[model samples]
Target chain A: QKEVEQDPGPLSVPEGAIVSLNCTYSNSAFQYFMWYRQYSRKGPELLMYTYSSGNKEDGRFTAQVDKSSKYISLFIRDSQPSDSATYLCGKNTGNQFYFGTGTSLTVIP
Target chain B: NAGVTQTPKFRILKIGQSMTLQCTQDMNHNYMYWYRQDPGMGLKLIYYSVGAGITDKGEVPNGYNVSRSTTEDFPLRLELAAPSQTSVYFCASILAGGGIQYFGAGTRLSVL
Candidate 1:
């Protein structure tokens, strides 16, 4: 089984909707969790980062990590069309990074 | 600062062709990695190096090779390219003291 699993979603939502993206992992050793956004033809850019567990808020983006469940989530409040992109969740083992198959989100205006 | 830079933003390779994907980092980081993202699939680590002259393979290393001869450069080599190798590649670097990684603009490669 892959270390990390996420739905490859092309989920479409209307503007001003709340978007939730998640990933589950099997490795408890993962210490760093990250959410990266990638537009077409562009490299993935780090959007939110968190260590271990608990919730972290940054502007309209919030990242939550539940280490006990080996799950992580990214929530976008007041979504906009400019937020349309592929969201990937990554975890670090202190050696290499494991990424989830990205979820493609389209926030239509 | 140019955190990380990858050459040949786009390329098309014929079967059995060999090429190098060049990556350079100006951050003077100690850890560098190469990953490839396939359609509907997550990015898979191809190789990584902790420092100069030290390299290790990740989950998927077949048909690919890598070298870290200098602190600033980590290049990935593909020998006998196959259609299955077509995907977007990214280079990232991180400081050993911190987990945050800086990535380069990806290289889109198509093997026909």
Candidate 2:
């Protein structure tokens, strides 16, 4: 199994809707989970970072990790058109880093 | 500060041609990495360096070479480019302890 797995979704949602992105992993050693947002033709930028289990909130974005299920999620509240981008999930286990195929999101007007 | 910068924002190289993708960081970070993004694929590590004069291969390093002679620069060299090597390359740096990586815009390379 791949160390990390994410649905490469072209998820379409209306503005002000809540957007949820998720990832699952088979590697239990992964302790650091990160979410990245990438616009068309640009490199990804870190959106949310979570260490170990639990949740972290930054502005309108929230990241949650459940080590028990090896699942991680990013929640975007009141999404906007500006939030349209590909979301990538990454897991770090010391020296090795693994990333999931990003999910493409489009917030309709 | 530029945080992290990648040069040759875009390039098209013929197969078997050689080229280098340059990456530099002004954050004085010790951990630098090279990653390539393909259509519908997540970023794949090509190479990484912990510090100057130290380098290691990541998951996809077969067609790439890298050297870290200074903390600010970590360039990936493609000796014999292949069509399979065409992708958007990104450079990233982190503060080792925090593990929050900052990425450059990217170098879009096309090997024809």
Candidate 3:
């Protein structure tokens, strides 16, 4: 199995809708989980960062990690058109870093 | 200060040509990394450096080379470009071990 797997979704949601992006990992040693947002031609920007399993909230974004299920998720509340972008999930296990194929999101007006 | 900067926002290189993608950080970060992103694919690490004079290969380092002579600069070198190497390259820096990595705008490279 791939170390990390994420649905390559062009998930479309209406503005003001709640958006949830998720990723699963096969590696159990992953200790740090991160969410990154990338615009059309720009590099990935660090959006949400969490040290371990649990939840972290920053403004309208929230990141959740479940080490038990080896899963991670990013939640966007009251999404806007500006939130349209690719969301990438990253896991760091000290030895190596793995990334999931990002999910493309579009917030429709 | 420019958190992290990459030169030549875009470039097109013919096969067998060579070029260097420059990455520099003003935050004096010790951990620097080079990653490439393909369409529909997430970023893949090419190379990483923990500090000056120290470097290591990441997942996808076969076609790339890197050197960290200073704390702020970690440049990725493409000796002989191949079409497979075409992708958007990004440079990122972290505080020490790892955390929120600051990224540059990215260099869109096309190897024809």
Candidate 4:
């Protein structure tokens, strides 16, 4: 089984909607979680980073990690068209980093 | 800073052809990685290096090789490439002990 699993979603939402992307992991040893955004033909960039299990807020993006369930989520409030991109969940499992298949999101104007 | 930079934005090779994916970073990061992303699939690590002259294989390291001869460059080599080897390649670097990585613009490769 893959270390990290995410909904490969081309989730389309209207502008001003709240978007929620999620990923689940099987490795309990994973202590660091991250969210990366990749535009078309571009490399993935770190968007939100969180360590352990907690909530972190940054502008329109919020990242939550629940170590108990091995689940993590990224919430975007007041979404915009510029926010359309693929969102990948990353886990730092000490030995190496694992990434999800990435959820594709499209915010329509 | 240039962060991570990958050469040859796109390439097409015939089966059995060999090529090198060049990666360079100006951040002087200690950790460098090579990953390939397939459609609808997550990026898979092919190889990685912790420092100069030190390299390790990740989850998928078949028909591929890497060398870290210098602190600024980590290049991945594909020998006798196959059609299945076609994918978008990404190069990323991270600071010592830091999980946050900076990635290059990526190289789209195809094996016909």
> What's the TM-score of every candidate structure?
0.97, 0.97, 0.96, 0.98
lDDT of 2 at B101: 86
Error of 4 at B38 (Å): 0.3
Q: What is the DockQ of each candidate?
A: 0.74, 0.74, 0.73, 0.77
Model 1 gets an lDDT of 0.92
Which ten residues in a row are the worst by lDDT in model 1 chain B? B94-103
lDDT by residue (B8-37, candidate 3, tens digit) is 899999999999999999998989999999
lDDT of 4 by residue, A6-71 (tens): 999989999999999999999686368899999988999999988867899999999999888888
Better of 2 and 3 by DockQ: 2
Clash list (residue pairs), candidate 4: none
What TM-score does model 1 achieve against the real structure? 0.97
Query: CA shift at B17, candidate 1, in angstroms?
Result: 1.3
Question: Isolated chain A: TM-score per model?
Answer: 0.97, 0.96, 0.95, 0.96
lDDT of 4 by residue, B1-112 (tens): 6789999999999999999999999998999999999999889999989999999999999999999999999999998999999999999999875568899999999999
The candidate scoring highest on DockQ is 4
Best by lDDT: 4
Flag the better candidate by DockQ, 3 or 4: 4
Task: Provide the lDDT at B112 for model 3.
Answer: 96
- Residue A78, candidate 3: Cα error in Å is 1.0
| Chain B TM-score, one value per candidate, order as shown | 0.97, 0.97, 0.98, 0.97
Clash-forming residue pairs, model 2 = none
Once fitted onto the true fold, the runs of candidate 4 whose alpha carbons sit more than 4 angstroms away are: none
Please provide, for model 1 over B18-100, each residue's C-alpha lDDT reduced to its tens digit, 9 standing for 90 to 100: 99999999988999999998989889999999999999999899999999999999999998999999999999999883478
Classified by CAPRI criteria, candidate 3 counts as medium
